[model samples]
Every structure is written in structure tokens, then in C-alpha cells.
Target: MISQVRSELTRYLRTETVGGAILLIAAATALLWVNSPWGDSYFTMTETVLPIAPLHLDLTLADWTKDGLLAIFFFVAGLELKRELVVGELADPKRAALPIIAALGGVATPALIAFVVGFGTDGMDRGWAIPVATDIAFALAVLAMTGSRIPASARVFLLSLAVVDDLVAIVLIAVLFTSAVSLLWLLAAAACFGGWALAQHRRISSPVIYVPLALIAWYALHEAGIHPTLAGVGLGLLTRVRPDEREDQAPATRLEHLIQPISAGLCVPLFALFASGVPLDGKVFGQLFTDRLSLAIILGLLLGKTIGIFGISWLAIRLGIAERPADLGHRDMFALSVLGAIGFTVSLLVAELALADVGDGSAVELAKAAVLVTSMAASLIGSALLLRRGRVHRARHEARALQPEE
Candidate 1:
């Protein structure tokens, strides 16, 4: 059973690697479409509204991608978090402390840098959360391409840190961005969550029964003025992580197995398509360096994230609050920290939420462009560092293998 589970995880990681490449393609396509002669049509398609009058669910194509499809991604994320907290690497209090501490640093430093950079700038301060995210798919893909000699522990560390980063981003979205709340609908959403938990406790395995309940919870949360993607997190946490003695796999594991491909392939790519379509003309490029918002995002992601994650991690290890993995060195940790700055997916979502109420979308456009450019820059820098490190590790391993026998 353990081997089988490992096999599944390996497959999932491979799929995510491919999915990351596809996501880049999708984002590039969106950018091209938006900047092409037919750019207005791209806007028109995204803005076309579809409304379910009875449920008060009205959304555009872009909204569906963000609020609807991205829920699948968050649900998968929540499942991963639950597994880690319950029986995975993070199951141990000591093992979890390092990544948790580093993730907090990762979140705080970027927000502080962004706030300081955008403090006096108009409408830029709202996007303080923009650099606090790390695109797991893209980062992992870059790591995988860095070569096979990279320590497995490095990947594990990166995954744990990214999960915590996502958790922080979710909280920011729920608390910092929400403008209003409706108690009645919020209560309804909570009730739905209760029912979902009850069903999980009862060992209800049928998707038919749970699907409608999930939709109801989503709708209620939407009406409650909370980001409905959070409904996915709530349901996922409530999933059963431990199987009954008679069963081989837990419900959460099974659900993750079923949903991960969908989330990676369809939902995330679709979200990237809609969310990354910034019209990058000459004016946007000219303002990329001069604009406070762009500078904040660039510095926060490129400089602040690297410094924060690595600095806090080093502090934690030095103080004996956390232990570095035996297989990983300071350089490896620093490379992973650089990868943490590739904050594409959630950062773009936060930029949209932050600038939603602003009349003109110039600030929004600038933020989106910054996220794209900075993420790419981080990826390149991280990949270079990891590649060099991988070669050194590989050479050391080969040298050890060639040592004289006793």
C-alpha cells in the first residue's frame, strides 16, 4: 500500500510538471490574444455575462475561471494540507515548524516591502498581498528541470513551504479583501459545511450526494460576500484523512486522487488563461520600472521573498527551533527560497481582487504585468542557481562513488 501511494504521488508530480508547461503556454496565448489586433474581442468574451437569476449567481467568463474553476485547485490544496497535517511530513510538530516559520516570513516580508514601496502611491497600497504567493506548479517544474541530482528533500521542503504560503494567501483573501458579509448566507454556508462533515463522518462515498451540497455551500459563500473558493478549503479540511481499519486509503486521499488531475490540467490552466491576459503595450512596459506598484511587486517578489524565507529559515535553524534537512545545504535552501518568489497564480488573483473596485484598470494592468515579469525573472534566477547546485552535488556523488575500496 505504501509503495502504491508513492507511485501515485510520483505520477501526480509528473503530471503537475507537464501541467506547468501547459499553463505557461496558456498564459502566453492570453497575452498574445489580448495584445493582438483582435484584443477587443478577448475582452468582450471575458466580459460576456452568464447569470443564474434564481441563485443570484451572475458571472463573466473570467469570473467563472477565478471563482468557479480555481475552487478545484484550492480544494486539492486543502486536501494536501490536511494530509500533511494528519499523516504526512508535517504530521510531526518538529518537522512542520521550520516550513511554517519560513512561510510566515515569506508572507510578511513581501507584504511589508510592497506596503513600503507603494505607501504614497495611489491605489498601489491595496495590492500589498500581490507578492505573498508562490506558484507551486511553476516552481516545481523548474526544480524538476534542474536535473535529477537535486536532493529529494529539497522538493519536500519546497512543497511544505508553498502549502503554508497558500494557506496564508487564503487567509489574506478572506480577511483583507472582503468588503462586506451577510450573516444569514454565511450561516447557510456553515450549515452546508456541517452537513458535508456529517456525511464524511458517516462514510458517505457517493459523489452524487456531495456534489449538490458543495454547490450549495459555494453559492451561500458567494452570497455571503466571502470568496467562494474558500468553500473548497472548508470541505477539503472536513474530509476524512484516516481510513477505517477495513479500508486501504482514506477519503481525502481518494478524493485527491480523483480530483488532482482535473485541478492541474483544466481548472488551473483555465484560470491562467483568463487571469494573465494583460494588454502589455509600450505604455505598460515604460511604466513597469517607474510605477510604484510595479516596482513594489518586483522588489517584493524578487528581493523580499528570497530574503524573508531564507533569513527566517536560517534564524530558525540557528536558534534550534528548526532543523535543516541533512541532505540539503544552505545553498539548496537559498535556491528554494528564490523559487518561492515565483508568485504567479495567487498573486494575479489578489491583484484582481484588490483593484476590483477601482474605476480605471490601469493599476490592475500594471500589477498583473508586474506579477508576470517578476515571476519569470524569479524562475530564471532560481533555475540557474539550482542547476549549478545540482551539478556540484552530482559531481560530489560521482567522486564519492570513485573512492578507493577499503
Candidate 2:
């Protein structure tokens, strides 16, 4: 019975729609829980501190989910990124140019818009980074549900763009969030990376060894004042993706298969539960539109993402710098841009880091609310557009099928 339940859960977790559906449910539960009459309990649960005295670690429930569970999600992201760089869509310069360019355009325009709007605002410095990330799981979920008649290359394009966006977000976290560094601890983290790479090179696959090593690396990065999540990315990239002559799968593939279900079904959803519990009062709603910080985030996501992604993609294709996916039209690309605007996971993480030092936690809360609002709006708009475009493609396919094979 237990194995049957486990098998069912694994199947569910492997589905694109299921992961995103669970994430949305988690976020909604958090929102409702924080606003209910028992709201104090929600706050209490998230704020309660847990300390590991030996390791000098003291963190709240929210922090643990963000710092620990979210790291696993990033680890899966890192593995996908490494796979792409080594053997997937991003392996060739000619094939890679379109998504890479779109990703850059996506990042730059949102940042520029946010900075321009919130130039003199207190959290502007960090808040500008929030809308630059595209939540891969969420975007892919919408695609799978609404774009069944679309070409497979559309999914490839979206995944590649999101992966590059993840890389940019990682760099930003490492560069912007670390205010001070302990060199000795940093060196310890580096040593951990060395050991991880060595393990990969030697084909050592013991969980006992790698698990503790990963924990130590995370701790070292935390002590070094770096965002400890980068440890997951580092270790994931170092894992071998190519299979040996006698092997069915490489270490990266095995780890990803083991870890991704846990990440999608548990880790990411838990982080959303903890991190997305912001209070949604009338004052917050007013601030979302009137306040520069929230306004910047919303506009950056809605406008910056749409114009940047679609515009750059069109130009690249027209100039012959990049090839367009066969049978997809300008309308489909526009829909993709709108979908790309749904920046949920990494955007929320950025909101926390960016406004962590801002006054009274209000800025952080507002930034998060803006992300949520923008993501919802993008999802709705993009889904509608995709559904309409899908019908057109479906009609074309049906018409072609009805005609005699010629």
C-alpha cells in the first residue's frame, strides 16, 4: 500500500501541470492562512526559530524553507542547465543564439524599467532584480495545458530562455547579496567544490559521502556570507552528465531523477508556502499601484518582459541571426513573451534578498505582492493568447489532414 502511494506521488510529481498546480495551491493556502482569523498562528509558525548550536545556525521556519528546501529546487535547475550546456539546445552557438538573446533582452529590459521607475526609492537598488527571472515550471505548466497543438520547439525555446534566466539570477544572488565575506569560509566552500568535482571524475556515487559533503558546503557558504543556495548549483554543475561505457546513466541523470520529484512535490511548494504569506490588506493593494517599488516590479514584469522578449525575438529572426521554430507565428511568440512574464519562484527569492535590509519589512512584503499579482495577470493573459493560437494551429492541422496526401 505504501509503495503504491509512493508510486502514485512519483507519477504526479513528474507531470508538468501537477507541479505548478501544487505550487499555486500552496501559495493560495499561504495567502488565505495569513489572512484568516487564525492569522497569528501562521505568523508564529513561520517565525519560530530553530537553532543548531553546534553549527552556529539559527533560522526561522521561513528561512529554513527558503535557504534549505529552495536550494534543492535550484539544484535541479542547475542540473538542467548543465545538461543544456553540455548536450541539449544550448550546446551549439547557432542553435543557442535565439534563446540566449531573448533571455538577455528579458533580463535587461525589466531591470531597466524597474530602475527607471524606482530610481529614488529605498529598495530600488535590489528590487530591480526581481522581475528578471522566469519561473520555468509555472511557464511550462501553462504551455502543457494550453498549447497541445503547438510545435515541440516552442517548449524547447521557452525552457532554454528560462534556463538562461536562471543562470543570470544565480549570478545576481552571488554578487548582490553577499555584503561581507569570510575568506577562510569561502576557501572551505571552494574546497568542497573541489571534492565534489573529484568525486565526479572518479565516479564515486556514495550518498553517505556526497550528502555530508553537500551539507558542509552549504554551511561553509552560509558562514562565508554567500547565499548558501549557490552550493547546490555548484555541486550540481560538477556532477557528471555523460554516461560511462558500462553505465545506464551518469551521476547527474541519476541524481536529477532522484531529486526532481522531491523538489517539485515538496521543496518548491514548501518554500512558496513559507515565503508567500504576505498580508494582503487594502493598504497593500493601494501601495502596489501607487508606490514606486511595487509599481516598478509590476511594470517590469508586464511591460518589460513582453516588449523585450517579443521584440528581440522578432528582430533576431528577421535579421537571420536566429532561426524561428517552424510553423510558429508572431502571435505565438507574443504569447510566449506574455507567459515569460510569470516570474514566480526566483522572483520571490529575489524580492526577499533585495528588500531584506529595507525598512520595517513593508518593502519586502510589497515586492512579493507585486510579484504574485504580476504572475497571475501574466498567466491569465498568456493562457488566453495561447489557447487562441492553439485553435488556429489545430485548424491548420485538421485542414491539412482532411486534404488528400499529396
Candidate 3:
């Protein structure tokens, strides 16, 4: 059982790591495409609208990428979170408390920092939530690629921190972005969710049963003005994790294994390709320092995320509220905290939702640019720290291997 579990984790990590690389390449391509002489083509491509009259949805390619494609990513996130809560690190309250507190700190501190820096600014009210998310896919990808000798428990800790942090961000997104709630549609969405839970209870594992229900739920939530992505999360969380006597894996595990690649490779990269193409110029660069919104986002991701995640974790361990995972040291914990600063996927989405109301699109562009720049820097710095720590771990492993039998 242990070997099987480890194999599953290895598979998950491998998929996410490859996906992260694709996501990065896609983002880089977006940057270059948007700046090329034919830059208008990039904008045109994202701006092109597809009319779904039957569903009463007419959305741009970018909107589909953000609202639609990213929903799959969130679904995968929900599955991971549910699995963690049920059988993973979060299964034990004692084990769970550290990352939970750290996640809260991660959210609170960066938001506080952004609020302070961008106080009285136009988008600050909504934009402060920008840095609260840690893109688990990207962050774990970095660890998988760079921290070869790092303990599995360290990866587990980072995953827990990021999953919990992203959960909070999702709640904030749902609350802060809802313009108006249609009661009827909300009721319909609720009905769908109810049916979903019922299906799970009855052990109905057919895709035919789930796919239509998920689609209807998504549509209902969209019409209800509560970001439809919540549908994916709700469905994912509802999926059963414990396999039956004759089953190899639970529905949740099976579904995650199937959909993770699609979410990571296609959904996320496509979203990044559409979302990361912020028209590059001197004005955008200038605003990184002079503009309060941009500066606030940058500082919040870099300094605030580091301070909040690492500080709370240290305090928790010292207070004996939670035990640190074995084979992980303070230096390792610190490096993991820094990795929490890599906010990419949902950060860009929040940048869109937060600044959508403003007539001037420049603020939105600047905010995203800040996110891209900050995430890149955090990845580099965190990777370096983790790599150094990894070498120490490798040496320790080698020493253990060389030791004589007792």
C-alpha cells in the first residue's frame, strides 16, 4: 500500500512538473507574441468572441480561458484538497494545524501589505487579494525539478500550504467578484450540487451521470453570478476518495489521474497563453515602481508571502501547536515558505476580476505584469535556496548509504 501510494504521488508530481514547464513556455510565448510587430494578432486572438446563445453566454477567448479553462484547474485543486483532508496530511488535526495557520498567514499578511502600499488607490480595495494565492502547480514543479534530494515530507508540506492558501483565494474570488446573485439560478446550482452529493453517496461512478450534472451546475452558477468555477470545486470535493473492496482507486483519485493532465497541459497553458499577453512597453515597466498598485502587488508577493508563511510556521512549531515533519529542518521550512511566493495561475485571474470595473485597462495590465515579474523572481530565488538545501540532504543520504550495518 505504501509503495502504491508513493507511486501515485510520483506520478502526480511528474505530471504537474511537466505541466508547469508548459505553462511557463506558454507564458513566455504570450509575452513575445504580444510584443512582436504583429502584436495585434495576439490581442485579436484572445478577444475573439464565441457566442453560446443557447447557454446565454457570449464570451471572449480570454474569458473562456479564464472562466472556463481555469475552472478545470480549480476542479483538480478541489480534488487534491479533498484527498488531503480525507487521507493526506490534513487527515490529522495535529498534522494539519501548521499548514492551516501558515496558509492563513500567507493570505492575511500579503493582503495587509498590498492594502498598506496601495491604500486609497483605485483598484486597491479589490486588488489586495491578488497576492494571496500560491500556484501549487508551478511551485511544486519547481521543487520537483530543483529539489531532487529534498524529503518527500517537504513536498507534502509545500503542497499542503499551497492547496490551503489557494482554497482561501478561491473563496475570496467567489465573494469579491459576485456583482449580483440570481436566486433562481443559485437554487438550480444548489440542486445540481445536491444531486452530485447524492450520486456520490449512492456510489454512482459513471461519467455520463457526472459530466452532465457538472455542466449544468457550472451553467447555473455562471448565471447566478457566482463564478462558475465553484461548480468544479464543489463536484470535486463531493467525489468519494475511499475505494470500495474490489476497487483499485476511488472515484476522486481516478478522476484526478485522468483530468490532471488536461488541466495542467491544456487548460492552464491555454489560459496563460491568453492571459499573460500584457502589452509590454516602457509605461508598464515604469509603473512597476511609480504605480502604487503594481508596487503593492510585487512587494506583497515577495516580502509579505515570505514573512507570513515562514513566520507563522516557525511560531507554530515553537509553540508546540504542531510538530514539524521529520527530515525537514528550519532551513528547509524557510525555503518552502519562499516557494509559497510563486503566485501565478489564480493571481492572474484575480488581476482580471479586480480591475475589470475600471475603464482604464492599463491598471489591469500593470497588475498582471507585476504578478508575472514577481512570480518569476520568487521562483528563481526559491529554487536557489531549495537547491542548496537539497545538496545538504543528498550528502546526508549518501552518508547513510555508506554507513556499516549495525
The sequence of per-residue lDDT tens digits that candidate 1 reaches over residues 1-406 is 4465455557657877877888888899999999999999989988989888887778998999999998889998888888778776688889899999999999999999999998877666568888999988888888888845788878778888998899999999999877789999999999999999999988889988799989999989999999999999989989988889988888988888789889888899889999888989889999999988899999999999999999999999999999997688999899999999999889999999997766588888889999999999998999899989999999899999999999
Q: Which model, 1 or 3, shows the larger lDDT?
A: 3
| Candidate 1 similarity to native, TM-score | 0.97
Instruction: Pick the winner on lDDT between candidates 2 and 3.
Output: 3
Model number with the top lDDT: 3
Worst 10 residues of 1 by lDDT: 1-10
* Candidate 2 segments whose C-alpha is farther than 4 A from its true place: 1-16
Give me the overall lDDT of model 2: 0.88
lDDT of each: 0.88, 0.88, 0.90
Candidate 2 structure quality by residue, lDDT tens digits, 24-76: 99999999999899889999999999989888789998999989998898888
